[model samples]
Target: MTRNRVLRQSKLLCAKGVFECEDLTTLNHGVFMSVKRKMSDEIKSVWSRNGANSYKEARDVVHRVEWEDYQHWLDLQWPKK
Candidate 1:
C-alpha cells in the first residue's frame, strides 16, 4: 500500500482505539519504531482517560486526540528513511 493510504488507515485504527504495534508494523510495510512509539503513546493516553465523566465522552476525546496526533505524525513525514 502507498504511504498515504497507510497513514490514513493508521489514523482510522487509532481513532477506533485499536492499537496493536504488530498491526502497525504491517501497516508501515516494515518495522517502524517511531510509529510504534506514537501508537503506544496514543493507547496509553486513551487508557488513562478511563475515569472521566462518561465512558463515551472519554472515548470520543481519545479518538479526537488520536486523529490529531496521527495528522501531526503525517505532517512530520514519520518513519523517515
Candidate 2:
C-alpha cells in the first residue's frame, strides 16, 4: 500500500481506540507470525521451483520480511498508557 493509505489506517485505528493501550508483547508476536508466514511461503515456493537459485531467493525473502517488519514498527504509534 501507499504511505498515505498507511497513515490513514494508523489514524483510523488510533481514533477507534484499537492501537492505544496495546500489549507490546502481543504486537511483536503478531509481527513475528506475519513474517514467519511470509517466509514460509516464499521459501517453499523458491525451493520447489528452482534448486540453484533457492538459496538466494530464500535469503532475499528473509531480508524483505525483516525490512517490512521494521517498517511496520516504524509506522506504529505507540499510545501511552
Candidate 3:
C-alpha cells in the first residue's frame, strides 16, 4: 500500500484504540497513542470554560490572559541552554 493509504488505515485503527494489523506494529501503535493523549489534553484545555458564563466570555478571558512575561519565565527555566 501507498504511504497515504497506510496513514488512513492507521487512523482508522487508532479510532478503535486497537492495532490488530501487522502493518501497525507495537512501536507505531504506542506513538499514535501518545500523540492521541497529548492532543486530547490540548483540546480539553483549549475548549474548557472554567465556569465562564458563555462561550464568548470564555474566549474573551482566554485572549485577555497575558503572556507578556513568558520569555522571562523561559529564560529562568533554561539559562543559556
Candidate No. with top TM-score: 2
Model 2 segments beyond 4 Å from truth? 1-24, 43-57, 60-81
The 10-residue segment of model 2 with minimum total lDDT is 46-55
Model 3 lDDT on a 0 to 1 scale: 0.35
Q: Put down candidate 1 lDDT per residue, 1-81, tens digits, no spaces.
A: 564465557757888886533333332322233333434534333321211111123234533334334445444434323
The TM-score of candidate 2 is 0.27
Better of 1 and 2 by TM-score: 2
* Model with the higher TM-score, candidate 2 or 3: 2
lDDT tens per residue, model 3, 1-81: 564575557658778885433444453334333333433423222221221111123234332212353233233322222
Clashing pairs in 2: none
Candidate scoring better on lDDT of 1 and 2: 2
Instruction: Rank by lDDT, highest first.
Output: 2, 1, 3
lDDT for position 25 in model 1: 30
Rank ordering of all candidates by TM-score, starting from the highest: 2, 3, 1
Which regions of candidate 1 fall more than 4 Å away from where they truly are? 1-34, 37-65, 78-81
**TM match of model 3 to true structure:** 0.25
